[model samples]
Target: MALLNDIDGLQKPDNHYILVLYPGAETYESLKNALAPLISDLIILKKRGFNQIGGYYWSVELYFSSDWKFLAICLGMKSANTLHFCPWCDCSKNEMNTTSKKINKSMDNIKVNYHKINGHTKEPLFHMILLHNWMFDELHILLRITDRLWELMLSDLRRENVNEEIWKEKILLEMKQLKISFQFWYKRNSNNLLHTSLMGPDKLKILRELDLTAIFQSRT
Candidate 1:
């Protein structure tokens, strides 16, 4: 009990905070740079049960206890299909299957039901997802793109003899297909004292520059 209390003390609540929510598993690193400020504060974090596009991080926002806090969702385009009926594993690949229509129908009913019973008491809620000029069908495409990127990144890390040039090209191509562009930046760190601090390692010398979290695939 004493140990738990000590850990709790480090998390002292700051009143009038902005609540930032995010789930675990594949969702952990999605909103990296865009969420740097809120993540630094460490307001609310939750592991959502089976991600939902509109409310994947809603579970995280709900964990906030502050009454005056404002809820801002990153609401990126690919975030919407995180909960849809798609399989992305080795077992399901190269096999013909259909989406879970029943699950789709059922979840829709729940969303509809929840939308009906709404009231505000403590903190005000806000959505950051861009809904303007968005098509209904593109939601699934966005999710697929995210899933593909996740799979590719993991593969690159684990697979043997991964081609750097080819893999980088693939990542860039994926970003291009999604209509996303990446910006580059450079920084000088104190750790580079010897100008050869961390580069002692062979593999760490090179890496892809794609921003996984900030990747936004505009509609084609």
Candidate 2:
């Protein structure tokens, strides 16, 4: 909390800024305990002579994870993968395995249904949204899919009656070409960091351009 005292001088009054706190699993309990008191002080400061409006620290914004299902559970969110997760909205994901069909048939609702409890428990806590990590969702998965595609290409090349040494050279060249393509796409319009920071709208736009129903022909 004391560290934030220095922050006031650096930014203008109306400018909005996020203060992200990343407390690991084990320290989460302690961090929560400490943050409560600090926020209370900030609220008090706002009420006093200080002009620091503390609304930003008062509420949670977003949560990130590789596994949406597990993150949903931790945040007391009903699976986004299910239709029943939204209470007010009347929409659902189509059961068809085809991604394109599902996108077309479904209305794509963003509302989240919070879990409620009565009996022994007092209150229910839930996150507003669960975001996928950039590394896991984009880079890692794309690399894996590309690797599988390259293996398939190599298998096709193997069936040729060319010499084994020449075939190996062809595989190396193919690998280099694939790597170059991935690099170009990764750094599409900007540097690595900016490219990886692609948000939901951009990702969805790219997906809409793909042949979502196309099945991979490679077994390797």
Candidate 3:
């Protein structure tokens, strides 16, 4: 599914437009073909301003936004776990922790170099938009960060020899108190505990209201 939103406009349901809607695997070739018509229209829109019925002209400034995985796929970049993982900059896996780096990548540079440059596996599907104009989904970033924090919390509980069932129950109880639906269960084939996949709002509640000290109090 591809959605187009007017950023400058009010946050309303009508402001969002669905460009493409289909069910299929999201691959480079698939996305390139799926978005071909949209891209073609965007190129023309960017070059020539769209004229309105009442003597008004709207100049389009295109921006592409998606989750990191989809963004990587669209940009024809390697997965985040790869050596040259970042789509925005030349930063490799080792340098990801560094903050003070120059923004050296541009759409022109990426187009010229294509697969030969900074983590790019092929030409970007949305080459009409500038590289800087490509935005990351904020919800995904929050979800991923909270996921890591949840993992670390679980590791800490395990390290302290906390009973799995007890901790799981405690977590579920806490989630219930916070009005967030969460659970822990084991698959038939796997010993690992799998929990409910929380959405952005639920994850935010967990991050803000989850009482870690209470969860660890019995161990201490």
Candidate 4:
């Protein structure tokens, strides 16, 4: 029962957060660096595990608990863990077929309906996507599922006005803002799979001016 903590009056941090659920340790750290700007107002960053005490079911509850602004799931290794029953993923196996394992399993004991879902969902959080390693584990069904989920969530970025330095960093140097960089491939690739080829850790470079300008425009 890891209830939400009221850190800094951010009662339900997910409301104003960019909730990230990652698996591995190192990539988790790197993502932390890239996402420092959105890490405020009691935002949460967790590395979920596959266990009984504080593992899978905990993640399932935390994930489906409430409507969040954005939920980003790092679909690591084709997300083979639950296959059809990723709590992070709302669609079930019977309806989506992508999650049929849930349907095949015994739900009488679990008390979950593997083939059905409630209607009128709040928007899913984050920009779920896959790293380039989609070829590693080699589960074609899971691979396709990950790819679809990635593109489906990315379509909501609202990039129409455009913000170059979308994430932020700042200081004053020799007559200039001594700013650091931010990544935006997560922004670009999020739109469509055809554009996924443009992804790379370095592909998204956002300096301060562009980031601010875009943020400002979104206000109007």
Candidate 5:
């Protein structure tokens, strides 16, 4: 839903804005209608000689939130949620033999099949990548887990075992500490002032190295 500006070999946010705001259920027809003009605009950019390479127009690179069903529709695929079907790589379980190992795929083969198999697609219109917003995903999960844990501690099964005042103090202190920790991590990990340009893949790489779960577990 946002255009990426290439800055120093990095795709960063420049003038970020919402493209659509609709009420009620969103369907494939609705999405295509909303997206058609943007796609046409990219084609116009090509016509204007804005982003040409090797006598061919470079397709626009689009990163979207991790909505598997929606992404499948965007990619002109029937589905993409199963382990058998990955847009990134080819790895699928054998259809004939249930116990057989997965079949690995070559990049060339995947691209050829992917472009050819879509019922509605004549050719790829853009380069799309799934974007799982780690900041929001982790924050939401962490807060929910914290809330549930607090509830369980105060439930009838364990309420009278510990002093309520002391328990509350401990829980509050831990929550405050986590908040401070997360702030520090955010400030350190972010390169842009607005924090809107954090690359999903780069963040995932950093997370693998840092292993924030271990840190959280240590605190608990």
Candidate 6:
């Protein structure tokens, strides 16, 4: 789904417009074909300003926003786990932890080098837009961070020899108390615990209302 939001307009759910909705798998070719019309429109809008009422001409500035995976796919970049993991920079996995590196990538550089770029795999689908205009959704970032923290917490519990059933039960009970629907289940052949995928609001509730410290303290 491609949602168009007016950044200068009202900040509400109703203000957003759906540009395209593709139900198939999100591959580079699929996305490129799906977004072709929208891309053409954007190119025209950028080149020729939109003419409104009363002889007014408004210039449009496009900003692409999505989760990391979708953004990587659209940009024709490698997956986040690759050696050069960052979409915005040439920073490798080793340099990601450092703070001294600067963002030296731009749309011009990517166009000039194409597949030769460290992180980029192919030509970007949205080549009309500048690289700096592409943004990562904040809500997705929060959810990803929450997932990592949850995984680390589970690892710590396992390290302390905490019973899996006990911890799972405690977590479900806490989630229920907080009015957040969560559960744990095992796959057909796997012993790993799979839980319900939480939305932004539910994840926020877990972060703020779910008492993790108390649960950890009470693991007897």
**Local distance difference test values of all predictions, in order:** 0.32, 0.36, 0.81, 0.32, 0.43, 0.82
Q: Per-residue lDDT for 58-95 in model 6, tens only? A: 77677888999999998889888889878777789887
| Candidate 2 per-residue C-alpha lDDT over 72-174 given as tens digits, one digit per residue, 9 for 90 to 100 | 3333345654654322223345533434322211111222222221111111122223222111235444545555554565456456555544544443343
TM-score, candidate number 1: 0.20
- lDDT score, candidate 4, position 115: 25
Query: Judged by TM-score relative to the true structure, which candidate is superior, 1 or 3?
Result: 3
lDDT of 6 at 19: 79
Order candidates by TM-score, high to low: 3, 6, 5, 2, 1, 4
lDDT of 4 by residue, 1-220 (tens): 1243445555554546544555545443455555555433222333342356754453322222321111212221123333343333345345465533332222131223422433212221222212121122224344455556444433433444444333111211211332333223445646422332322222222211223443344335
Query: After superposing candidate 3, which stretches have Cα over 4 Å from the reference?
Result: 1-9, 161-166, 186-191
* Top-TM-score structure, candidate number: 3
Alpha-carbon runs more than 4 Å astray in model 6: 1-9, 161-166, 185-191
Kindly list the per-residue Cα lDDT of model 1 for residues 1-220, writing each as its tens digit.
0112246463555423344455543222445544577544433232332356775533332222111111112221122223321211112222326453221212223223423322211111212211231123333444455556555654544354544344444545655654455322235663211111212121121224444443231110
Number of clashing residue pairs in every model?
Answer: 0, 0, 0, 8, 0, 0
lDDT string for model 3 (67-132, tens) is: 988999988888888898777788988997899876678887787787678688788877878888
TM-score for each model: 0.20, 0.30, 0.87, 0.18, 0.37, 0.85
Error of 1 at 57 (Å): 43
Clashing pairs in 1: none
Give the C-alpha miss distance for residue 40 in model 4, angstroms. 2.1
